[model samples]
Each structure stands twice: as structure tokens, then as C-alpha cells.
Target: MTFATFIKNTTQFLFKAGFIFWLILAILELLMPGFVIYYINMQLWLIVVCCLAVARAFLCKEISPPKADAPMAQK
Candidate 1:
């Protein structure tokens, strides 16, 4: 695979993972009154993870595109 494809796939994976983690935390918080602290901590971590994932998705780029005369190579 190419670098761009790798970045896209990894970013999407991270986003999905983060979303699932946050969802679980939310459900736990709703189900248990004593889980406030856990909820807060999880929320903070989730925010950080989401930010990092977005940054990685936006910032990562392939160094160069394949030239018209060049054969494409898989990463």
C-alpha cells in the first residue's frame, strides 16, 4: 500500500477505536453513579486520543506521487 493509504487507514482505525472507547465510558457512567471519576478520566483521555488521531490524519502525507512514466510501487 501507499503511504497515503496507510495514513488514511490508520487514522480511520484510531477514530473508530476512540469512538468506541468513549461510548463504553459513557455507558458505564450512565449505569453507575460511582463512575464519575472514571468517566472524567476516560473523557480526557478520549479527547487527547481524538486530537492526536485528527492531527495524524491531517498531517501525514505521502512524500511524493508516482511519476507518470514510473511504475507504481506498493508500500
Candidate 2:
């Protein structure tokens, strides 16, 4: 596997896993109310931000227009 492929897969995995993990944490917090659980639940926002950043990075990596200095249009 190439480096690009690995990065792409990893970022996608992170997004999916983070979403699922947040859901699980939310469920646990709801089922068993406590100070610790509430604090842990607060981290869901952090997880969401991280997942969005990962997704943005992956998309940015995949989207790059041709460089202006490389060449000019033939037509």
C-alpha cells in the first residue's frame, strides 16, 4: 500500500470510529448518571471537532488544482 492510500484510509476510519465512540459514551452517560460520566460526556464535542478536522484534512489532501507555475494552457 502507498502512503497516500494509508492516510486516506486512516482518516476515514478515524471519522467513523470517533462517531461511534461518541455514541457509545453518550449511551453510557445516559444509562448511568454520575459526575465522571458527565465529564466524559462533555468530551463528545472534542471528539466531534477532531473527526471534522481529520475529514477536512483528508479532503484537502485529495483536492489540489494544477500549479500555476508548472505550465500554461495550450489553447
Candidate 3:
């Protein structure tokens, strides 16, 4: 496989794992009160910022405009 494909798949897997992590956190928070309010200690804001940055990078990569062809010489 090409390096670009490998990188894309790895990023996709990471995003899936991140989704699962948040799902588990939400479940725990729902099951036990104050789970998010007091128990968690990591820098959630930093993580959120990083996630948004990565997402934006991928978005821009996919949404970039098509390159225009060179114009033909005038007759």
C-alpha cells in the first residue's frame, strides 16, 4: 500500500478509537454522577483542540480546490 493510504487509514483508526473513548466516558458519566465533574484529571481542552486541529487538517486536504490546466498558446 502507498504511504498516503497508510497514513489515511491510521488517522481513520485513531478517530474511531477516539470516538469509542468518548462513548465510554459518556456512559461512565451517565452511570455515575460526578464522574466528569471531579474524577477525570487530564487536560480535556488540550485534547479537544488537538482533535479539532487534526480534523481540520484532514478536511482541508480533502476539500482543496482542483488544479487548473495550463492555458493553450494563442494562435
Worst 10 residues of 1 by lDDT: 34-43
Residue lDDT tens for model 3, 1-75: 988777777667666676677667777878987787486643584486468558746743776577898898899
lDDT for model 3 comes to 0.68
Q: Considering lDDT, which of the candidate structures 1 and 3 is the better prediction for this target? A: 1
Taking the tens digit of each residue's C-alpha lDDT, what string does model 2 give over 18-57? 7776777667777877734646545766667586766757
lDDT of each: 0.74, 0.69, 0.68
Question: Which residue pairs show collisions in model 3?
Answer: none
lDDT of predicted model 1: 0.74
Clashing pairs in 1: none
Candidate 3, residue 33: how far the Cα is off, in Å: 2.8
Residue pairs with backbone overlap in model 2: none
Candidate 3 residue-wise lDDT at 38 = 82
Q: The CA-based lDDT of model 2 is what?
A: 0.69
Q: What is the Cα-based TM-score of model 1?
A: 0.53
lDDT digits (tens) for residues 1-75 of candidate 1: 999778777777777787877788778877986686643677577787879676776766557866687666879
Query: Residue 54: error of model 2 in Å?
Result: 5.9
Q: What's the TM-score of each model vs. the native? A: 0.53, 0.54, 0.49
